[model samples]
Target: MKRALLATTLCALPMAAAAEGELNLYVWSDSIDPALIAKFEAEAGVKVNVDGYNSNEDLLTKLQAGASGYDIVTPSQHFLKIMADQGLLEDIDAHALAAFQQVDPKWRGQWWDEANDYSIPLAYGTAGFTVNRNHYKGPVDSWKVLFEPEADLQGKIAMLSYPDEIIGAAQLYLGVPFCSEDPAEMKRVYDLLAAQKPFVAAYTSDNIENRIAGGEVAAHFWWDGNSMKIRFNDNAPIEYAMPKEGLVGWLDSMVVPKGAPNVENAKKFIDFMSRIENATAQYNFYGHSAPVAIDTATAKYTAENAPELFPTVKVEFSRSCSPAAQDLVTKVWTQLLQ
Candidate 1:
């Protein structure tokens, strides 16, 4: 029996070694450029295999089912909190990540990781609008553009299909807190969103840029980086704007799965990415803020190209939904869409 057991253990060693040198990554499609992956691969000598997901919930479901396959994942801050709470994430060792100090103090010590124990803020951006310059008959400064779709843009505007974003826009317009937990307030926001739904041209998240570029739509609700990417591609006299009602912002974070095999390589990669100059390069390429420590260079880059989004560096307070609130938002959103 001892000799048979020894043979089985020896056979499994090769599989374990293969898994150790390989890092399985699940991320948003096109979130990271291919060149970046090449750099990591050449430097670390580790094979990085990546998969894509369309939504956060899908990532969560997979992680819940034992994420033995994924070593690194890109998740929004809220979901990071959820994963940390469920003990699904590996507690990030600050010592292993010496470059943690390179992160902006503003992003650290937040509710998601009050002690900076679990995740690293990778990228930050906002929810906002994209407008075709030719179609805008007036100032496009507020949520009113969507809530009360202007005559020229009527039937030409596209709204984000997600429940939290749609209802949060209404809540911001209504002057209710962005992440209001009050059930009554949430209901009011839901009603407001439903009222504006008819004016919206099909609920959707993707293809907004295609619709706008093709002139199938005149305006789109979009994330700041995505809007910038679209504008960069075509420079078709399109603009992205934040509403006067105040916009919601999100920090996309990198966290390790609890059972991650390549912990050391993962830490090194994260540290390297958090260097201010390196992070700036990513933001310049991707059009989103990197979470590295703020500096003169970061400021100059933002002021030059994305002034509207730069204001967020000082807009410290942001609303994040609790799980209960998320469930409620989902339920009300389903009804509103129905």
Candidate 2:
């Protein structure tokens, strides 16, 4: 339920404080807490400057367009391989860092970066929808609630402005595999979205918690962490769904981009973030599952309170789509919005 004024462009953010050093960060919107950044600054004497993007495509587009001032970027597991394949990230020897040892064994050796050579694991979560329980008195265990809403949620559903996970969700609902290049299969996705368009209150990715909490919309496509945050912090009567179909798994990692302005400072920030205390601070602030060990009682949320974070259903992590498949996804989303 926190509101931050970060915009999509690097120009919207100030450079950094007048410290001996600085680390420029480009990450997902509202993903990092300011207090944590300040703590890093105070501890390392390196000012941390940040800019945010709404989706993975935005980050990829920025880097492809030659925005290289960022020392560290937070990209999901899939986009990590995409950016690295384009040679836009730095090989910071993340695996060799002492803090890497603290990383949960399950999060290590991820396919996105070999042996964690190019990236440091950050927060992980699932993509799903949340329903305001006060409005709907029916079962809440399926994507049907949003895609084919009941009387209560009619014209009161909101989806992410970005298409990455929305398309993945639709694919799951249709039983189509992620990154399916079949045109006929993709057409079904398009048809399904088009059918649900009339029920959409808005397609947005900004201030989602407020929109849902304030009742501007009754159901919303959202991340598990953010949903739990609104529930725990604002005491909102909302439940994040683990659709019977499946959930999209996502892992955001700390990576140093190629041609970064502050190399050593970026390393310092990574080491600082890897510490258990600091990692716990990040988890408590953002409400996402962390790859590093954290003190649970000292944390803000628990499995008992925010069950959404722990999913029993299968979670299909997205992969980098082929050119044709990605283009079809863009077409499906754009056409549906129009």
Candidate 3:
């Protein structure tokens, strides 16, 4: 019965039948501007019900646990591949979305969803570290400062709570593959993080910007976009840097989940977000660049003032590691927390 239902849904034609109802959006916290949601509601005559999750794993767990009522979801590129393979997402008809053309060709046909079958690129950025310039005077150019802390940085650093990211950063710093399967390589990453745990002020993924702004820690492992958002809006004396050891690049895309009650509305919302003006507004609000290009003036302003938002160094996109590798990292992460 499950197979039959899925096959039927996949065979159904792309239809905008429910164009003026509710769109249940499950995305990252503070990711969408409420004002934009209000605008979308007013214009489309559709009520959007918004829900938030912090990590991609959180979103995946809910969906896997049979949670429903989410018309749309935002998953990072790596998780998108996993979800797509599991048939957790509905196929997107590129021909049905007029604004699909607005997205850059580079973001389209990505390895995660080749042929753009399951996801639409929403925002893209790098994961790195930020420094409170008021407290740390030395150069913030390398992962060593956070992983192998100097005297000043010791006990004044915050690390991301996610296993894949913290472990991946350690892998890069140690010059190992981001998704290495070698037990020795994995153990080295685990040992590195375990050693740094004593120096870490906290392992957290929530309100990281606020904590940094409030001087809770002198340095943190954070996303470039969030770092920029904090610097611009909170006027925090913080600076983001792509570590000398390659940075991890991520792209979060919009996908309609299987059994979405408002599939048409989800498609419309994705298209609405793909427009240049809307995309620019989102970027300005969240500090993450949309995968689509914006107007020349806005692009120029970003180039001149917020150059760090664009990474120029070597980048490694996050990839799904083998289950055994994931298990090892999770084990070490749990130990570090204890």
Candidate 4:
């Protein structure tokens, strides 16, 4: 009987360890500050075990493959829809999440996942080039710099490696709809990106900061958050701008995975994160624009200080592409990168 009791205690130890405090989160590497984790843990009494991913596809692949350890995840708005449709996400109970009402109405029923049923928007930003005021004498408000490279920028410019962003930029330049579900429209966008590929310095998803800061490349298409990060860290003379034809943008969200272990806690965590104070801190720390409701201090900060930051509209203008279009875009991007 004594031995059986000891065995029972041992069995309960791991459960206790898992239960007393632990929320596994998978997000972009180096995106969130360690302090944010500590604060959330201290506030909610849960240890956050975070893992980071470099790409949305990687996150989706793992979730789709039935890897079920995470309590929370951050993926772009489109990926959130995909995950929700695949039954990989929990239907976010608005009642359980009081802070969700704090989310802006404009972002609430976005066409991608209308009614804010699937996830909560965390941050928003656009993809564009940061021109070096010191060197770039020409007008800098357009996607034309990279698509139609000038004599000076030839071979010295960089473009994103992602199909959505690169192709979307071309579509925007041509005044065509972006994130098109129509395969033919997508193909046209892909061909345009591929045509511009030869002039690209390298198909890159990283180091736009280093390239821009070091002057290794005069300009490159980069996320506004990443561009802001460069500006914050180096305080460079560089600038982040929306393309004159308008910029390609993205909205990222926090979601509860289908099989998350600590869902009540996940909802609590989401509530804590949704507050404008926390969101502003995240934005200031990481330099990515944070999703803020109207009339909040963070929204005021953005308007007063960083007015160029804007909401992403492609997900609304277009249906975010069907799987067929995604595959075709991927194939074309792969070929162009080769």
Best by TM-score: 2
TM-score of each: 0.86, 0.93, 0.91, 0.85
lDDT (C-alpha) at residue 8 in model 2? 19
| Best-to-worst ranking by lDDT | 2, 3, 1, 4
Q: State the lDDT of candidate 2 residue by residue for 79-116, as single tens digits.
A: 99999888999889998887798799988887888668
Q: How do the residues 75-120 of candidate 3 rate in per-residue lDDT, one tens digit apiece? A: 9998999998888998977535766788888887888988777788
Count of clashing residue pairs in every prediction: 0, 0, 0, 2
Model 3 off-target regions past 4 Å?
A: 1-19, 298-301
| Model 4, span 197-252: residue lDDT tens | 66777877776677877777777777766766556556776777655577766788
Instruction: Name the regions of candidate 2 deviating beyond 4 angstroms.
Output: 1-18
Compared with the true structure, all predictions reach lDDT values of 0.71, 0.85, 0.80, 0.70
lDDT of 3 at 138: 86
Better of 1 and 3 by TM-score: 3
- Name the candidate, 1 or 3, with the larger lDDT value: 3
Off by over 4 Å in 4: 1-19, 179-187, 293-301, 310-319
Better of 3 and 4 by TM-score: 3
Clashing pairs in 2: none
